[model samples]
Target chain A: MSLSTVAGARLVARKDLRIEQHSRVALAQMLPFGMLVLILFAFALDPSRDVLTRATAGLFWMTVLFTSTLAVQRAFAVEVDDGALDSIRLSGISAASVFLGKVSALVIQLLVLEAVLALGVAILYNTDFGGWAMLVAVTLLSTIGMSAAGATYGVLVSRLRHSSTLLPLLLLPLLAPVLIAATKGSEVALGQEAGQSWSWVALLAVFAISYLVLGVVLYRPLLEET
Target chain B: MTTTFAPKIIGTSSPATRILGVLSIIGLIALVVFGLVISPADFELGETIRILYMHVPTVSVAYLAFIITGVGSVIYLWKRSEFWDLLAASAAEIGVLFFGLTIFNGMMWGKITWGVFWRWEPRLVTTTVLFITYIGYLVVRSIPTDTRTRGTVSAVIGIMAIVNIPITHKAVDWWRGLHQSSTIFATVDPDMRGTQLFSAYLGLTVFLVIFAWLLIHRFRVAWLSERARGIGLDEAIAARRAEGSFS
Candidate 1:
């Protein structure tokens, strides 16, 4: 019998997160890498200029975008190595499930990373957060949008020979709207810019929803290629 | 195996293509005349009105090509046909070229009119995003892979990437609050009389013909390369056999 989408999603997610829990890749590597990036921004733009404080939202999201590429690369690496994806295929689960599973796991991991990054931004960039409602809304939508798009493109490039180098090239341009929306919305949230942040949040919702739909519909074909 | 090793005629030209070429050339001459000498300068835009003749059509054709690419991607996925795949890839290649022209012409328009080559305006950002999306598409297409895999992955991308144009436009619009006077066509030239309208229409028609001509050529080249690869595989095997069993 073909596994139900929900069941398959659960199984795959559990498998991935369980593997992550054992390996500590995200905790040990991604979190610190994200923090180092936060610190490096300080080095790149001297803190005395107070540019980081004024530009906190942009730097924070830009850092997330960079580290998320690494996260996506690592997420796909596990399946592509050692014939694991092939076994998953033979088990009669849907590709959509695998896509959803990977995206969910990436979402959780990235949320954790973003949380730490938010803290880093608070401490290092000296950002004072306000507009709590829009802040939470934009963060949630942006993460989902990033994770869904990343997962879709992630599986597409996973099996390629130069996939490590190729994934960002394929994924980053697709995520431009998210970056713009998230940055602008977060700027409003952080009291750096003044405007209708909800409209930007709406754009993020539209982006996240469309990518989620596209990811579900297109995952089968992408997985077959893999 | 005894075989005819003669090189296959891979010429993409034909009677139809020749007709397209001739029509395109004729249209282009007319477009130039209408754009430069025939059409009067606008009350507001002056000589800068001429750039719109090229700019508007290129942007229109770029969007048209991308829409076609999206449709082709959908059909390719549904039918699993190489023809649709080739059509999608061809349209995308042409779309990228047109978008490049659009961006360049747009920059000229912006600099002359607004005193800057680039701005954070909605159209500019949206255009650049679409351009970059297809650049990624073209880059991924260049990587060696099985035909089906390449087609499948590219089809998936083509389907989703098109959604970005609207999302980007909206995001930038919301972010920037879209000043009405800042735009080119909307505020200016809402109503064109006589020769001005004619020239605008003429430019659009000519560029469309040019786009069709380019699309046909690009599709033929992609199809030809695939055939050439197949023929090359046989030749490589034959040459290996002639080397006396791995000599």
Candidate 2:
């Protein structure tokens, strides 16, 4: 019997999970990497509590942005190899669904990284951890937006020559608005009362949705042409 | 036989070309003389601001060329005509020239005004991005064969990046308005007694004519190059066919 939408997505997600089992490619070294970033941030920034307090949110988001790029860049590499991407397309599954699965997997990876990084920053920099819920929400939304934009640019340019360099150039500019909004959102969650933190969160939500839709719609044509 | 198309600014050897060439030359002479000798020094930046007569119009012309490239890109995608593709490529090639000039002039103005040649200010950053995007367009084209796919992709990206032009112009407004954003292109009042303004318009007209002349020449060059390659391929194929027939 054919699978329902939910069933199909779950099945595809499981297949990816199974593939990841042996390789353990996804989320590999994420915790340690996030720790490395936090340690680096400590050494780079002044040791003053005042400085750390102000720079924590920016530092956290920057870490996420860079780490997430590393994560998303590999999101499709496996499927692209061994002709699995073509097979997936031929599998009568929605590209959007597959995109969602990849994004979901990435979200899981990012959430883990963020949790560890935020905890480390909190313990080290004396962050209050008062807005943990808001931190989680912003992390989720921001990751979705970045991953969607990154994945779209990734798929579009992957077949091109020098795509590794091209992807960052194209993706970074598109990701700028997201990065700005999300960092502000995190600042709000951290109880740094710059007015309109919620507004920034709202903007992140809107951006996430826009990039999601753009990725889903553009994926079909982009993949077909490739 | 291969026919090479050379880009002409005002005219070829034709009489009409000679007439337009003469007119453009006279217009340029009058504009330059009026601008340098007749235009008054500015109240604020003084003599340095005189560069605006040349700088502003060149940037505007470059923007005009890019806008046309965007239009040509859209037309190519819609019509799937090589003509439109050639047109877009030509505009981009020439657009880069004018854009480079604009950036150069901007640096000169920046040095004189801000006392620095480069800054990460919104306007400057956006202009740099625009320059990079055009250079990317040219690089995308210059890659080895497979013009069909690469050309279409470049065209789509070109049209989409037009979204950047307005955004760049408005970056200051949207984020931080800087360096006197113009509300209207016609903001110059009749009170302005600088002959440079009038002379600038004359320069604009001459440049527009040059743009058209170059477009015609570029289109012909691309078409002939394609034809010359096709002829070379055809002769090789015919020679092979004759050999096969004898064998």
The TM-score values for the models, in the order shown, are 0.95, 0.75
Q: Which stretches of candidate 2 lie over 4 Å from their true place?
A: A1-22, A29-53, A93-117, A120-141, A184-217, B1-31, B69-78, B164-196, B199-210, B213-247
Q: Given candidate 1, what's the lDDT at residue B70? A: 94
Off by over 4 Å in 1: B1-5, B185-188, B238-247
The sequence of per-residue lDDT tens digits that candidate 1 reaches over residues B155-230 is 8889888887788777766766764563653422657778888888888888898898889988999999998899
- Over the stretch B44-104, how does candidate 2's per-residue lDDT look in tens digits? 5577645666665666677877888888887876787888888888888888887787678
Tell me the docking grade of candidate 2: incorrect
lDDT per residue, candidate 1, A52-80, as tens digits? 88878888898899889988888888988
Q: Which window of ten consecutive residues has the lowest lDDT sum in model 1 chain A?
A: A47-56
Candidate achieving the largest TM-score: 1
- In candidate 2 the C-alpha lDDT for residue B152 amounts to 65
Tell how far residue B233 is off in model 1, in angstroms: 1.8
The count of residue-pair clashes in candidate 1 stands at: 0
